[model samples]
Target: MNESIKKVAVIGTGVIGNGWIARFLSQGYEVTAFDPAAGAEERTRLAVNHAWPSLEERGLAANASKDRLFFKDDLAEAVSGADYIQENVPEREELKKSVLHTIDQHARMDALIGSSTSGIKPSILQSDMIHPERFFVAHPFNPVYLLPLVEVVGGEQTNKKALEQAGRFFSSIDMKPLTIHKEIDGHVADRLMEALWREALHLVNDGIATTEEVDKAIIYGAGLRWAQMGPFLTFHLAGGEQGMRHMLEQFGPALKLPWTKLKAPELTEELKERVISGCEEYAGDQSVSDLEAKRNEFLVKLLALVEEYWPEESQAKANI
Candidate 1:
């Protein structure tokens, strides 16, 4: 990892773009953002300010001597000397291709570019880039400053060095980088999450439970276990001394039972209303900002617990 990679450019100023800026700036990177949209500079500044306290609370902003940040109106100026570039524009293929094409013509050749794409494959995202090897997907969850996971995916044309450099860069910022071996739709975490989401929707549609109850099923039960250990590891523990293989052998037959419908339910108007109403009811007296703050607090504490207990295979990189 290069300690000298102090400059980064963030392209786009939407919600995700603000998140990328927060994560980068909190890690002491001098972030320069480019977003031609009206009020983008103000929005980015507000997001960064809001994130600063959280970063300080986590001991991530120990080095405050560095310049706070910079916002650029010129795209060329933003990418001119950046060590890395993070693209968080809308998920329009043509728009992405156009932006990357322009960036390819302007950015430093050796600078790494990452896309905050949730579902798009890197191959498709970088098809038109002049230097595709320097570009790849570095998808991070919402509120990137809180969630540490960054899924790094390389396309067929992606440079190995770029991927390795991305891993190092994300680690330097205290992020858990998971490199996908192949280009797959939705990558890893989202795919697993979508599967469960489909079932959750199905249950709601079938009137098996209200949305709040379904949320309870997660927050009050298996979700707690999942936060500490993955499903396989949790099941291994469930099997006691027998471990996963033994548990699988014993439970394999029951797996065929019609427990869950993998099919997703249609987002009908009534279902949508039900979900909205359920959330509104759950919210009670809390405003959206208050609820969000509470949620973020829980996530930070939960993740800290995970790090303390079930450390990842790449735990050594956390100290970088």
Candidate 2:
């Protein structure tokens, strides 16, 4: 709903692409999407329908409607009139570059281009574009309609004004835009997540903990506190009256301890089976769809609580 970006185009229809579509539609943007897959439109519509209830819980824009979504089989036609284009194609480098070339050829000259790539640096992704200044990475978490954080990273050629506009546009759609001026592989959030993921795999691979136990450790302990204040702030409180200073003084030595394996374990056949079977056993009778619905419900309520208790302007400024 940003004044300058009314018509939006999503250039893929996979899970992430559909998630963007649902979020854009809920924000009342007229979304035109393109995907070459068979029944891509049908699948996207179903995905939107599945996410609609959670969006309703979060509250939709006054003019929001599923009817506002449209699909075009031709990529050029889909993006021709859009003010903003979000590409969610697969992470394959050459495929992304080729798709971006087509988008660059057809999209309006001034249209802002954002890639939903989780890890690829924006610089490399934009290198082949004629209007690279308008291109950047706008990575969002899974369940894009519910998660507010979007890492907006600019490439070397990206114009500051364009990046600012992208940030403002995302903010208008109820997103927390973390503008990362420097480009790096995986940006910020994903790197932090990857670190933890590496250690988790190590634990499972080493026969130290079952996947279920790992989930419980986070769910019942750190995850709860992390939902409110992240690691730094949580540890700041852990320092008691002296804050982070005391906490660091007391625990800094642990940083050198070999308690964690930062490198991820190899995904051997046995490891894969263990992970797959463990998850299946934990899931029991619940299908993936059922779990997704439950997760959406929990996220809706958690988002509300987070908004109520989390710090606002001051906290954000302090982080900088």
Candidate 3:
């Protein structure tokens, strides 16, 4: 096995996979990718090209170039001798496990495999792998090149050393590596997001607020605080000198109040139309691609501001 990651193989070049490829290439890693879909190479290349300007603004690595990307029709050829591997297959457990098993068979023994699965447990995906210890979940948010947060969760059979190395590798790529202490269905961020989404659905189902209204509520309020401080810390400050303890005491009774729906509302046709129509009204005539471009532009600016504000942490993580 190679001693360090010089080349990376990206398996399943969908949105997430292509994002991973762009990120690796921006960091100057030779990236070989494979996807069986028709026009996979074209789509992946276009995705990378679309993402390149943002990456260039962020500053590319010395060896970073569009020329470093290679597309392979064969999965085995893509993985063989690769120093690092990133798997971004579908969410299905059986399919992901099957692809991972093949990737493990072909990749170098010491090369770590990071899956882009957001919800699936690493243990389930690695169950069929011949070398399960080398595999772990390295879930990143959408627009993976700009977003630096990556949740690194290891499985029961996953080697602790491999997790550490994976953290180092992700950090080296200018990402925030969150090593989850335990295995859970949704991991960390997604679980928190799921709770909020369920309540939002209930609100929309009851006609209490339109989807756009709910989004505006977040966009103009708690969302801003959440960008810099977590919910607990934000509430802690709300306690005013007494900290989280006082905040909990003051609002603890609200926990039992019928203020939220933990269970998601039914996706009835009416509610779907209301939500879709409301979103469309809010979006005007914009397509999904148009929204994505706007989002990436805003994200790039925010990423730079945050990095500048917390230079010590972000830069130190990048130096890993």
Candidate 4:
């Protein structure tokens, strides 16, 4: 465990898993990736190629290169010598449990295994693992190569030392790991996001707004501030020097008003079609790959800006 991680294993080659492999390789780790899905290797190669430009702009490590990635058909062979393992299998409870248990049998006992699960609790996924203490959640946002935030949540059987080790390793790869003190299904970011998603779906289902309109509401408003400071801190500034207390006092009464729908509307065929068509309209003539490249480039610049300005607030608070 004291040794530096030279090799990492990625358990799936889907979007999340592909991103992880690219991120790891960009940070100079030799990565061995395995997926049971047909054409997974080809998809992984294309995904890595598509994401490499952003990583290069962001700056890669001394040894970082796409050539460092290896594909393995056998799961055990993929993880055999890896110092760390990231599981990006589909988010099904029993499926994750089974996959994790199987991985546990092959991977080095000391290697920390993390799930890129967006919502599933780690305790359940690690239930059948031989060394549950080394298994935890390392949930990263999409386009993992560009995003710095990664949620690190440990299960009931997870060891604190193992979590610390994993967090340190993730940090070394330039990720900001937020270690959740208590386990939650969606962790922190996703829970807030799910609420906003449900509200947006309600808006669309009620014919109040199109998907593009909902997106504009975010891209032009709070999303800008959110890149630097979180909602709580941003609202504290809205208090006009009285801080969050005044902000809460002024806006607290509005909480009783039914301004939003908490429950999501059912995804009926009409709703699905509306959403799908709206997305198509938003895309216009751009293919999925085209849109993804644009998004990644914007995110790379945005994250760089955040990294530059984000520390100012912290320094100012410290001066106070």
Candidate 5:
């Protein structure tokens, strides 16, 4: 834990917000959270309970406890004394700005504010704030408690020291903070994901593959390699002795082929129902909670395996 950031506040209780709360509690941070929705506190507690087993498997800080979470009805009161605040409101531009303005007004001036937005740029999100310099995008993956990657991006007005502190704080909590020097829509991971998603939708819409088939393609093949070395190094290995240089020389022309439709297909009613029914059929008897539990267990084991093979030096080189 960053000693300068003892108290933390989470300013929403949606899926992402609850995930953040679970992670903070597991890391032994006292978290005060606010959300206006009725029964928000109950749902958050339930989410924490659901995620606890995974956190325990990952390992817990000495002081970690679910009881450290406090629910406050008033947003101002929730943020007033916090040294770090995370905003995870729904992805409406106007609403996020309004809520951020309120947090900026109430939080301590030195408090570092991070938004868990999936796509919005940090500069636009921090534009209306008085202390915009302290604000940045801290976009995290779903299942935030178990997933270690957090994309840390500073806004145009954001201070270098603020980004540095946020990186250090996230690192202390057992997270891999990837600081993005340039901001773009969907940051880094999500953009790559969105491209693949668009292509997957196109395949489904064109009747080329079923949802289950698409999933199987990734699950049995690229997903396994991606889990460790990611796309570049995986492709590099394809070059045999020559590595990436020879691989690119042989396959680079394939990039110009019409192998992908970058634009996403429209979500017509037929497509929507096909997708919903396909997923439901695939899910069969298992509830979402059941699947989540299984996924968490798998990830805990996979993460352990990943750390063994994907050492820090290799990861740094891959990033470069």
Candidate 6:
């Protein structure tokens, strides 16, 4: 694929949309953004500016041209002649359906349309679209320019060509694109993350650990391994010379132990209060921006390390 990715359109200039803009702009794509909310353009510009320095620090934005970003009040104007269209609207089903419908009506037939939806499946969201085949999920984690994992999920009506095109497009921008085999609620990463979040909430509710301690348990333990490799790969390493088979044989019995609760905990008020309080206490001095900057910094370094360790294979897959 060519390194050039000119004329990308971003809908909904919120946090995720802003990140998408940054990623595209850093990759030398001329970004045209549309957002109905007032002051959305200013917010997007601020996000792009803030992200620029971080991208520069990581050497990803070197030799990349700037001033290719454009903002528009009209969605159709943004989508016209766009090479790729990324929709990052609110998570409401009706809102997404409406925006996609409009995009389907206005966007060029060949332009790829992707959603940053976290939980909503593309089938339901793109049900009202005239060209659902051109639509698919390109879900990215928060602060999209830094993180490299973009879950690419296709709906029932989503075409194979579109998925392939999207996969290629993300790769051009140095993103890791994981094509989900089937549509599942919350997709892959979010489903696994939600499970962990539920358990964390349960532990807090049970007074087992504070939010900070729980966070430390992850950052100090498996999270370090996960930064370089996933759970299965880590287990494969844990197996020593024998591999996963040996590891499983040795620890399979632990699965029977009461180690984790797979069931989700009910969001009762008392439990919610405990979780909220714990988080607030943990987040005391740092503002959201401060924490996000720290996270972006860490993610940039971590992904760069992964790229260095397993350059060929990992670089071909990971996208944010």
lDDT tens digits, residues 1-320, model 2? 23499899999989999999999999999999999999999999999999999999899999899999999979999999999999999999999999999999999998999999999998899999998999999999899988999999998899888888988898899888999868888899999999988888888999999999999989898999999999999999999999999999999999999989857889999999998898999999999999999999999999999888887634656332
In terms of lDDT, which candidate is strongest? 5
> What does each candidate score in C-alpha RMSD?
2.6, 1.8, 2.4, 2.1, 1.8, 2.8
Local accuracy of candidate 6 as per-residue lDDT tens digits, 128-247: 988888889999987798887899999999989888878888877878899998999999999899988988987887789888899999999999888877889889999999989999
TM-score of 1: 0.92
Off by over 4 Å in 4: 312-320
Q: What tens digits encode model 5's per-residue C-alpha lDDT throughout 1-320?
A: 13398889999999999999999999999999999999999999999999999999999999999999999989999999899999999999999999999999999888999999989999999999998999999999999998999999999999999999998899998899999999999999999999999999999999999999999999999998999988998899999999999999999999999999968999999999999999999999999999999999999999999988885656556441
Candidate 6: minimum summed lDDT over ten consecutive residues — where? 311-320
Winner by lDDT between candidate 4 and candidate 3: 4
Residue-level error in angstroms, candidate 1, position 287: 2.1
lDDT to native, each model: 0.84, 0.92, 0.89, 0.90, 0.93, 0.85
Can you give the TM-score per candidate against the true fold? 0.92, 0.97, 0.94, 0.96, 0.97, 0.91
Q: What TM-score quantifies how close candidate 6 is to the native fold? A: 0.91
Expressed as tens digits, the lDDT of each residue in 182-225 for candidate 3 is 99999999999999988998899998988988998998999887
Q: Under the 3 Å rule for N, CA and C atoms, how many clashes does model 1 have?
A: 0
**Model 1 ranges with Cα > 4 A deviation:** 1-4, 65-67, 311-320
> Which RMSD does model 4 reach against the true structure?
2.1
Q: Which whole-number lDDT from 0 to 100 does residue 47 have in model 2?
A: 97
Any residue pairs clashing in model 6, and if so which?
148-319, 148-320, 149-319, 175-318, 175-319, 176-317, 176-318, 176-319
Clashing pairs in 2: none
- What lDDT does candidate 2 reach at residue 105? 94
